[model samples]
Target chain A: MIQRPITVLMLSGLVLILLIGVTPAAAHGVEITYALTPVQTVRVEVIVHDLAGEPVRKADVTVFTPEVAPGDAPAAAEAELSPWLETSTDRNGWVSFVPDPALAGSWQIAVAVDDADAHITLPLAEESGLIRLASDQGISVMSSGLQVTVAATPITTIQVALHAQFDTGEAMDEAQVVVYAPDNPQDPFLTGTCDAEGRYAFAVDLGRPGVWEIQVRKAGHGDWLKIDLDENAIEFEEVPVDTAGDADSTNTTVQTVRLADEVARSVESDDGLSSGQIVLMSATTIWGFVGTALYFSRRRAATRPESESDN
Target chain B: MPRRFVTLVLIVLLLSSALIALAQAATGTLEFYANGEDFVRQGFVSKDGWAISFDHVYVNLTGITAYQSDPPYEPADEDAELVFDVEAILEGSYLVDLAEGDEDADPLLVGEVDAPEGFYNALSWEMVPVEDEESDMDGYTLLIIGTAEKDGEVIDFTLGIEQSYTYTCGEYVGDERKGILEADDYADLEMTFHFDHVFGDGELPPDDGLNETAPGFAPFAALAEDGVLVTDLAALEEQLSEDDWTLLVDILPTLGHVGEGHCHATLLDDVGETAE
Candidate 1:
């Protein structure tokens, strides 16, 4: 569905997560000490406005609290979620609702101003006593772009995993992959195809440090990612960090961010894929590091993102 | 050509052919649609008691692109940051009449594209003036020719809106989920325009948000001249009062939706009549 600009209604509020523990019952050599974890509730102040910054008066405001606390959300099925409270913004566009204070995470808030509608996310911090979350766990600069083999390990040489997935939750398996060095944008640097997983792997010759471009194209659709490699390390440039497609197709979310961080740590602590080859390429006297090993560190890839994500 | 050069050319050709084959194997077709809903087809009474029926509702669309997202794009998320790599784009401009079929007609099909197989959850569309000033729809993005009758009096009306809008949305939110394509399979997405939001549904309460925001056919009927009215938003703005003009402009952006879902719409200032 197209989104109504109701997002002009900015929701800001003070929030806290609370966990209440019931006293354990002990009777004649038996002990019941299980702690009951309730959902979280945080107070919020919602201010609805039009794009012109004028407060929208008498608008209907409703908030949908998360049915389960963070880390406790059901893996597969969505529980029956319902509206927490139904209220109206005052003349000043000021309206506040305290959720039953149960779940600790993000809550959904909707406002119907005049006839236009808006839906906003009310962020609840993790510290707000949100039902003491279960343990949860991504890589170095490791989100949706290539890695320079610099963030984690100390090797000059590196490997890149270029991922091509434009639609939400789906892989661009077998996409056409092409590489272009900064020196020649018109001619091809390297030509190849992605594996069945929409990923193309290649070793970045950091020894030949220069800005490199990788393009993943399929059917008439394609995108470009820019990689800058210098003496300090590899830095991603002009890469889109957000996405356009958000369908529930993959049933899994790729943690591109921190993927690099994780890879870096792994190299420092020795985790994930095995490290490979150290070729001694003839070096230029000014910048000579011919013996730096090339290890297979994974990288994230994306180029075009939706305009909405730009903000 | 020398043997070394000839051998290199052969290798390049073979590699290109292999990549093309791989792309074909991973692709499918995705279709795009536009729907004016029952208000434009079956016709409905405006909240002000005007019976309105459309003979033609032409909308021009362009820049249609579809994409797959990792976290699943929620068009409703205000602060969402979207990321995507490859995506399907339906290039060129297209014009479709929402009143082409009968009352129970299916949504109008705009076009289709060969896309990589993925769960395409997000889409974008734009409405611009038809090309060439000589054409009937030229210089106008939206054209509505309809009839409205109230209290035994009939008025033939032609409402031409020069305003343009770009609607980017996430997912289809109707009976069944759409835009899920498998290799060799076909999927579809829809761009829905809720005319009721502009005319107001008489079935709904007078106090309803849609009705309150809509200017209703009553305002247009009052602007009718000798049982026939053909005018644009500029003329209407001058003829209608300040409150009515504001109400109409506010309602215009609310016209587009995705199967009961909302879209993020931007009124293009550089195109058409250059609306304020």
Candidate 2:
């Protein structure tokens, strides 16, 4: 009876002490959670803390998500001092992001607080409450019966990429892709055909902030994503490179195999003429015109004297 | 000198002169003008002892054509066999405000046309309600806003007429003689819009001339008295009976000057000199 009483008292005391220590641990860890919305927007949140178990305010958190198809290995998540959708933790050590459809994927959030970095990849589970991870690969075949995904980045020119596959799990290429504002459905603001890779990547200048829809169709099946735009959605804060700390102090990287190599290689032929190539082409054409004009003028001048002498 | 060289030099000079002349005679300009006459507001005396004054007079004028006659016309001949070839002129509606007497304003110059250089003898124009999608002016071509006073009572009238009339050279020949156009000339034709003709008598609506059976001016006149003011077209339509609206429609064409181009043209003799 005496042993039992003493053991119960010691166990109760240890439990009380652990509960008291848990409060500090909770405030000292930077935790991030996110939801990959079916509407093609990524909702991300980050809770940051200091070593002393205090909420670290304004800690820079850079989230990088390399867009990859289902079953493909994500590229190495390098420590980017200026990631795409970056934000700072508030007084509650919390920061969130509902990234635009252009930035939807398995986002790797890299948090740097007090020269220490932490990373997390969302969504955390195959079937989280917000993201329905139906595939071992992070492929979300939406309930709209379209096996396609949309990804975007908050750049001056929003780069949107569409990855589509047929019901037979084959890449659907040369699909008819149309993007337009809902209010102006008749005017297909952007219309193009998907390449042989079942990928259509294009840059659009979102002149105004409003909801836009993308429609991708192959055969008779189609996929759509409603993109919401706002001031917070189109802008990002770059992560600061802490020159005062160790260079490799917070070089944390996290990646998830998102899509298959077959899907990724299918869109390998998507490279088109770059802006520099276009400029070079225009210059060459102009020089060719000048050279042709000079040659013809010289020939005409040389022939004029012979004609004059004959006359 | 060789005959061939002389012939070649003459041919070059002749060809150059002919080309220059053809280039010079390529186009002729016609300027339109409005004549409010003595029947304008503030000074006009109606036949029925009422002192008449017009505020606004809007007329839709169209189908203005210049004609090439085989022989020139006599203004006062008893019988003249006149044949004319129609030349295209300006076609548009113009608001002729009797009160807007500014010479440099747009109201003064109704329209202007650039035509090919040719001798034009007869001018024909129609004062008609617009029947085209180009304008909303229909039924009555002219809208006359005026006030008449006799004794102590004042009558404010919005006289509407839906009549369409084509006035050729004969209708405009009397009094003011026009219908001659010179090549490379700028013709300035002054159209006379007589407000006195609208109201035959000083009567609120003249009793005669305007047919009253189907639709005419007499019924519109019966709708008003010597003291009431009719404001706008909507107000007039609201105040008048349905039959009176039909009468207004019938009388609209007959309200203003049927001979729209009651004019005299100042033909240009030289490039800058005007033949008065």
Candidate 3:
């Protein structure tokens, strides 16, 4: 009986040895990790090793972004990945993948090695802002060949004066002029060119209160001006003008004084005038007269010399 | 259990032994042979209708061990004047009587054997006329005799003869003359000379410049058999126009010369076609 038991033990030992001899050694699975950046790309690296810590070769590997719940599988899982983005390691047993236009926000990456699996979650962020646009001087003209202005006060009624002069410095009869309000540039508040003496004037009614831009354009030349208006604000508060002088001798002074007054009045009124508008109007009136006078004077002078020579 | 293990080991050993024995039982063998001596003969009719024969005969004995005489020629005694000195004999020739085969067959004569002197140590039999007309049916025959002995004395020997014949005639066209102008109705004409080398030499002579009084050697210059000079320009013009003689004549000078040593001629129906 004892011999039988001994034989059974020996048989059992032999069976154990055979099973152990056939058993396969454990294989170390690969672990892959990824880092992503906006405007750049995400990089994935795979590391493979055997149970003995020796690098293994010919290990089939694949990597891709995982699908989300209740949705179709990600396209990347089914498509051929870019060569630069997908790479297998040389005999050394290392592989890497980089996502072009790196994924934004959270992304899950899955990596498989010789049937084993592993994954990593990557968080990507986009770099912040880079572009802007604004006006240079507080006010700008629209495309209609006119002037515009922002204002602090409401402009109720605005009056523009007229004056004229011939090339010989002699005053003339009539002139044409055109003026435009910011609200309606196509329809001018005033229209006409300078008359024989080169002078013009007009007035406009402010429909409502707010910043208004006035535009002054020479008829034939298409030259124009734009000015911001804040009716509640003061204009000539910055300029010192001499208001005492004979209107005739002071014409030059008056021109300057009137411009200053307009500016002040425009600013003080419910619809304040833009400093730019006051300046442009004053300059236009004065220069219009001066240009006409200079032109005629030179013409007369040139004719006189020719006539004299003919005589 | 131990007995069972021992029995299993014996079974594997026996199986392997059987497998080895089976592998050794299969066997195979291979063999090879060299080509034998060969020869061929051909015949053709010349453009001028003369019977011509071309014989290309060779002996291949790299592996043959013996040889024998062909056709009418039997082995001659050692003292015979025309005894074939195999050591000195490289080639041989014979003539066939073509008339025996058909009444209309042209006569074929063996004129001579032109072989390099000293190449062969013996002079074979004279040109014997074979009585076999059946043999001449094809206008040619090849006969080979010799033993292809590599390292031993010559043994069994026999002769092989292959005969062939081509009924078409062989013709030669000469170079054409350029820049010949004639009246519109007087189309240019060309003369072609044709002959067969089997007629021996001097059948045709060199060409002399036009207008020369000497009789020209051109075939068209003289009628075959009669040797009459064709000098009538009107008749020549009529023949030329009938055969588009102008074209043929123009291309005659450009056909250059054909055949080595011998000359022949052909009249082209259209010289322009020939030139193109």
Candidate 4:
């Protein structure tokens, strides 16, 4: 056999070098991180992560909002300097900001991750005055359940539309709807009942801009629901409801689909869904993250340790 | 156990004793005052009657003396008679009468009088009024004298008269029924009568009139001034032997006076000592 010492030496050297180099590389993985420059200035948060689904730390980052040019090409706009970027992340790899005179519109958080780059855009919108109520199946329902809304201006008048149904899911006409002052449950300001379509409309002069509660009950059934004026599932509009008939009809429901279409068409003539869109988008984003985190954590735990080792 | 019972008994006894002592202490005392003074001494009546005589002869002392027959029958006779001129002191109107004890004896007047209206006579043969006015000492002294005789010779003699008076105390002044010689409101009177005389008689009358012929006298009349007399010297001696005049003097203010409108007499026992 030819002398194998040289070959063995070469192999040992290669193995030793590989072990020495890979240890540091594995310990220092590519990470992408960004943080607000000033601390606690506005209600803004910055997040960064790597492709491996791990929080990226110590990443030089920049932020921009997307703008449209005349050529129909996307261009980067100079970010309006946020007032709340005075702090960096701690050892926990987290950063937060509360922008003074907070920024409006979309905020682009871009990160440089160990020679690789990624970005996230958070569409910042003003707080919504909208509230929605739906049945258990995720379809919006108007069947004897409560909905509430808050207003941006000092409220002068309040309009309430209700649809009541019985235990058999049949429309319950002539159900009494009483609007009470929120703090005092006994003083009912308005009393009315549903029509043949299980729909009731009440007009109330709120006297002042404040929270109120509406109570709906079928004449014979004990089940009733209360809707607070400032709850999350309703929309408060300053415009007259007749001006937004189509939107109102779309957002509202009666016993029949034909009636719902009529109502929507009536509400469509007014302003678009202005206040309700912000609240809906926020709710969607929050629920998306919550569902994603829950699924990721549960799926990670349920996978076998042997399967992960093989990967 | 016995000790406790004894203690209980002792406590009960102590309580009862204290209650008894408290009850006894609740009794009050009675004090008697004579007039306004506290001292009352010897008090009594004089000895004498309304008349006096010497035999059946009537004699007169034309110049305090008289002449009579031979050597054995000396003219200077020490046995003389005395009579009390009782009428001169009778300021209140009264009646008088005379009667003889026998045929040989001279007829004598011995009767009572009617006391004047609204007046009380102290000296009268009878009819003693409630009070005597003339005897009241407004710087006046009453002197009465008399004499008696039998067949031109001095024979058996008697001199007697009653000195009576009225007295008053507060609102009680006189008794209308009794003459002046009888004190009215007699329970309030304190009086004393004194007599001074010389008698050649054999024996004096008893002071309290225990012996016959010696009229017993009421030594002290509490209210009415009846003929309260001391008939003999022995009784007077017995009363005055002790120095009890201070007690009588102390009682004088309460007893007050009868006729004199003051103390009737200072020497209360002397009246009973010289009775005949």
Q: Residue by residue across B194-251, what tens digits does model 3's lDDT show?
A: 1121111122232211112211123332332232232322344553343334533332
lDDT of 4 by residue, A48-100 (tens): 44444455565544433223222211133233232112223333334443221
What does the lDDT come to for candidate 3? Answer: 0.26
Question: Per-residue lDDT tens digits of candidate 2, residues B173-276?
Answer: 12222333345767555555544444443443434331122242333444566565544445567767886665544333322221332222222222324433
lDDT at residue A119 of model 3 (Cα atoms): 35
Native contacts kept, each candidate: 0.00, 0.00, 0.00, 0.00
lDDT of each: 0.57, 0.44, 0.26, 0.27
Place model 4 in a CAPRI quality band.
Answer: incorrect
For candidate 1, give the docking quality class from DockQ: incorrect
What lDDT is reached at residue A283 by model 1?
Answer: 17
**Candidate 4 A-chain TM?**
0.25
Worst 10 residues of 1 chain B by lDDT: B70-79
Which whole-number lDDT from 0 to 100 does residue B100 have in model 2? 67
DockQ values per model: 0.01, 0.01, 0.00, 0.00
- Summing lDDT over every window of 10 consecutive residues in candidate 4 chain B, give the lowest-scoring window: B61-70
